[model samples]
Target: MEIFMKVFTKKLFAGAALSIAAMSSAPSFAGENPTSPIMGIPASSLEEFGGREGVRAWVESLFYYIMLDNRIAPIFREFGNPERQIFLNTQLETMVLGGPNEYQGASMSAAHADLGITMTQFNAVVEAAYNACERNVIKYHTCNQLINALAPFTADIVTR
Candidate 1:
C-alpha cells in the first residue's frame, strides 16, 4: 500500500505539474475580471484549477503529503485508502469555489472532535497541503482563497 501511494503520488505530481504548466501559460481569468462574482468564488477560478480533475489531484496530493509527514501521519494512520475520501474533499472544495454543494459529511467540528488535534498539527497539515499546491502549480492567490473559505472550521478542526 505504501508503495502504491508512492506510485500514485508520483503520477499525481506529474499530472498536476503538467496542468499547472498548461494553465500558467495563459493569464488566470479568475483575478479582477468582469465575470468575478460579487458574493462568492467565481466558477472560472475553479475551472482554472482544472475543475474536478484539479481538485481531485489536489486532495489526493494533500493526503499523500499528510501520510508522508511523521508529525501528521499519526492522525491518519488508522485510515485505509484515504485516497477514497478525496471525492468528498473535492466536493467540499468545489462548493467553496462556487460550484455545487454536494458535500454531505459531518461538520468540521463534529468530524474532528474525537481526534484531539492541535494547532501545531493542523498548521502542519495546511503547510503540507500548501507544499502539494506548490508542486501542483496551484497559484498562491488561489490557494489563499481556499484557506480563507475553510478558516471558519479551524476552531472545530483543532480540538486541542
Candidate 2:
C-alpha cells in the first residue's frame, strides 16, 4: 500500500503540474470571458463528480483517508468533528469547485499558523485529497483541475 501510494502521489502531482501549465496558456471557450474560468468552474466539471452531493461524499472520503494516514492523522484529529467536516465540505465546494463561495472559515494561513505543519505533512494531505478524488471516480483531468485550483494555497497552508 505504501509503495502504491508513492507511485500514485507521483502521478497525481505530475498530472496536476502539467494541467496547471496548460491551463495557464489555454484560450477561453466560445462565448466565455477570459476570466470567467477563474471566477467559476464550468458546471460540466461539477457534473463529472455527480454534482454537489458527490463533492460532499468526496470530502467524507478525504477525511477517511486522512485519518488512515499515520503521517498526518494526528495533526488533523482535532478537525474530526461533524461540524468541522461540514465546514470543510463547504469550503472545498467553494474553493476548488467554484460553488457558492460560502466559506466562512479563517484564512488558510491563520488557520494553520499555530499548527507548525511541515511540507511533508501538507503533501500527505494533498495526496489524501487526490485519493479521495479517485475513490469518488472523478475524471483524471477534473481531478487534476481541482488540484490545480488548490495549488496556490500551499504557501498559506504549509506553515513550516
Candidate 3:
C-alpha cells in the first residue's frame, strides 16, 4: 500500500499545482462594458431569435435537455422548484434578447453557492446554454455577448 499511497500523493500535488497555475494564468475579470454588442443589442433585433415565442421555445428545449441529460440535471435538481426554474429561464432569455424585463433573480453565485459546484459542472451548464442558443439560430456573436454579460456572476456560483 505504500507504493499506492506515494502515487496518490504525487497525483494530488500535481493536480493542486496545475490548478494554481491555471488560476494565475486566467484573465482578470472586469465588468462587461455597456457599449459591447452584447449589452447593445436592441430588443427589436430579437425577432431573429423568433422573438418572445422563439425565446420561450428555446428555453423549454434547453430545460428539457438539462432535465434529461445526466451530466447537468442533478445540479439543477439540487435547487428544485420547477415553476421558479421556468421563471428564471424566461428571465435569462429576456435579458439576453434585450427585452424590457430585467432579471430579478439572485446573482448566479448566490443562487448556486450552496451546491458545491465544480468547474466541470459549470462548463457543462455553459455548453447546454450555448446549445440552446444555437438551436434557435441566434447569432454566434450574440450568444458570446450574452455569455460575456453573464460571466461576471461566476464569482458567486462557483463554490469550489
Candidate 4:
C-alpha cells in the first residue's frame, strides 16, 4: 500500500502540473461557485440525458467505472452505500442542467477536503463520467456540455 501510494502521489502531482500548463490559456473560472448550476444550457439538454432517471443510471455507470479503475478505486472505498452516492450525483447532474436543485450534499471542497484528492484522480473520474454518458447514449455535444459545466469544480475538488 505504501509503495502504491507513493507511485500514485508522484503521478498525481505530475498530472496536476501538466493539466495546469495545458489549461493556462483557458478562461478564468474565478468567482464561479463550484456547486452552482450552470445557466444557459439548452432546455432540451436534460432530455438528452433522459431526465432524472437516466441521469441516475449514468451515475451508476460512472461509479462502476470508478470501481473498476485501480488508480482511484481505493479512494472511493472510504465511502459507503454506492446507491446513495449515485442518487446524490444524479441530483447534482440534474441541477447542473439548470433543473431544480435537489442535491442534498456538501460543497465539493468540504466534501473532499480530507481525501487528499489529486488531479490524476479527478481527470480519471471525468473520463469515467464521459464514458458513462456515452454508454447511456447521450448525444456527444450534450456530454461535452455536462463535462464543461463540471470542469470548473476541479479547483474545489482537488486538495493536492
Candidate 5:
C-alpha cells in the first residue's frame, strides 16, 4: 500500500509541474508582439501619455523653453519665420504622436552647421525636451523611447 501511494504521489507532482510549465509558456491573449518597433505597446497606450492633448502640450512647452529660455531663442528670433515655426511645431507634434505626418525639417547637421551649437547647448536642449515631456505627464519609458528614436537626428542638427 505504501509503495502504491508513493508512486501515485510522484505522478501527481509530475503532472502538476507540467501544468504549471505549460501555463507559463502559453501565449497570452493580450496579442502582444515583443519584437515590434513600438515595443509591443499598443496605440491605446497613448492615453497614458495624455493622448493628443498631452502631445500638443509637450511640444508647446518644448518650443517655449527652446525659444525663450535657451540661447537658441535668439538664433530663432533672428532667422525663424513665424509661419515656419508654426508649421514646424505642427509637424513635430504629429511625428511625436505617431500621427500621419512626415517631418521635413532640414537635416539636423545642416540646420545647425552655421550656428556653431556647442555640446553644452545640445545637452541643455535635450534635457529641456525631456522635461517638457515629463511636465505633460508622458510615460517615462515612452518618452525615452521617443527621444531615442529622434536622437539620430542630432547628427544632422548639431554641429561645431
Candidate 6:
C-alpha cells in the first residue's frame, strides 16, 4: 500500500505539472470561459449528450470503465452503492447541462482536497467519459466539447 501510494504521488505531481504546462502553453481565448476551437464547428452542448437519461447511462458506463482501470479503480472501490452512484450521475449530468445547479454536493476543490487525485486519474476519468459517450452514440466532437468545457476545473480537482 505504501509503495502504491508513493507511485501514485509521483504520477500525481508529474501529471499535474504537465497538464498545467500544456494549458499554459495553449493559445487561450480572451474570456472567462473559453471553448475549444474545433475547425470552426460550434461548441456542442449538454443536450448533445442525449439529455438527462443519456447522461445517466453514460455515467453508469463511465463507472464501469473506472472500475476496470487499475490506475484509478482503487479510489472508487469503497464508494460503491446503487443509490450513491445514481445520485452522483444525476448531479454530474445536471451540472453539465447548465441547468439549475441542483447539485448541492461538495465543491470540486474541497471534495478532492484530501484525495491526492492526480492528472493521470483525472484524465483517465475523462477518457472513460468519452468512451461512455461513444457507447451512447454521442458524436465524438460533442463529447469533447463537454470535456473542453469542464477542463477549466482541473486546477480545482488536482490536489496532490
Roughly what TM-score does model 2 have, to 2 decimal places?
Answer: 0.70
Predicted candidate 3 versus true structure: per-residue lDDT over 30-135, tens digit per residue:
3121111234355455566675677677677678767876876887777767568777766555545554344556655567868887656666666766788788
Off by over 4 Å in 5: 1-48
All candidates: CA RMSD (Å): 12.9, 7.2, 11.2, 9.1, 19.1, 9.0
- Residue 15 of model 5, lDDT score: 42
Per-model TM-score on C-alpha atoms: 0.71, 0.70, 0.65, 0.74, 0.60, 0.66
Model 2 pairs in collision: none
Alpha-carbon local distance difference test for all models: 0.63, 0.63, 0.57, 0.69, 0.53, 0.60
Error of 2 at 91 (Å): 3.4
Relative to the true structure, candidate 3 has a C-alpha RMSD (angstroms) of 11.2
Ranking 3 against 6 by TM-score, winner: 6
- Count of steric clashes across candidates, in order: 0, 0, 2, 0, 4, 0
Model 4 Cα lDDT, one tens digit per residue, 57-82: 88999999999999888888875467
**Lowest lDDT 10-residue stretch of candidate 3:** 28-37
Better by TM-score, candidate 5 or 4: 4
TM-score of 1: 0.71
Better of 5 and 6 by lDDT: 6
lDDT of 2 by residue, 120-158 (tens): 787787788889988988887887666656665566666
Report the alpha-carbon TM-score of model 4 versus the true structure.
0.74
Candidate with top TM-score is 4
Higher-ranked by lDDT: 1 or 3: 1
